[model samples]
Target: MLKNFNWKDESGFTLVEMLIVLLVVSVLLLLTIPNIVKQSKSINDKGCDAFITMVQGQAQAYQLENNKVPSLQDLLAGGYLKGEQKKCPNGKDVQIDSSGKVTEVR
Candidate 1:
């Protein structure tokens, strides 16, 4: 059976072919990684902005109910916002000014 087997009939990828495939994959990754990072940052920024808007709305509601501008602590204590919601989604703290305007800490 060994004698009948033909070595030339077998086909397989050569080292150069494998290297080329690896190189292609590496190049693709390099191209996509930076864009992915940028998109992630953009998503975080948008999420933070939306979070601020929601918190601002809640603060306004609190002001309307109490007839006064509320501080961040007041919002938390009055049950207008949960404790976990004191910070933006990006881990930035949100502050309520005397005018009840919500701003994210830089």
Candidate 2:
């Protein structure tokens, strides 16, 4: 009979499967995004602190020897500071004055 070839047994996915998949993906995304953001912020802070330390150390060493803070570029040129001398972590230019003050050049 024609009924023998019926498609009555065919069924699409139930709502439960769709919801579960969506929930799992959403939870994973929520958990991952915050961690990524936190790590980026932490890295930025650490870099800024490092540059600050270098500038201070150079200033102190210069004052102890020459009785004044060295010129910003002089610190690097004289082999006191190591690493890229121009860029800070937040995209600011690291510039120090003769007064041992660090200011963003840009």
Poorest lDDT segment (10 consecutive residues) of candidate 1: 82-91
lDDT of each: 0.88, 0.77
* lDDT, candidate 1, 1-106, per-residue tens: 3667688898999899999999999999999999999998889889999999998998889888999999878888999887667877678888988778889888
Off by over 4 Å in 1: 1-5
Per-residue lDDT tens digits for candidate 2, residues 1-106, read: 3556557787877799999999999999999999999999889878887877777777678778877677767777777777557677867777777578776675
TM-score for each of the candidates: 0.81, 0.59
Q: Candidate 1 local accuracy as lDDT?
A: 0.88
Pairs that collide in candidate 1 are: none
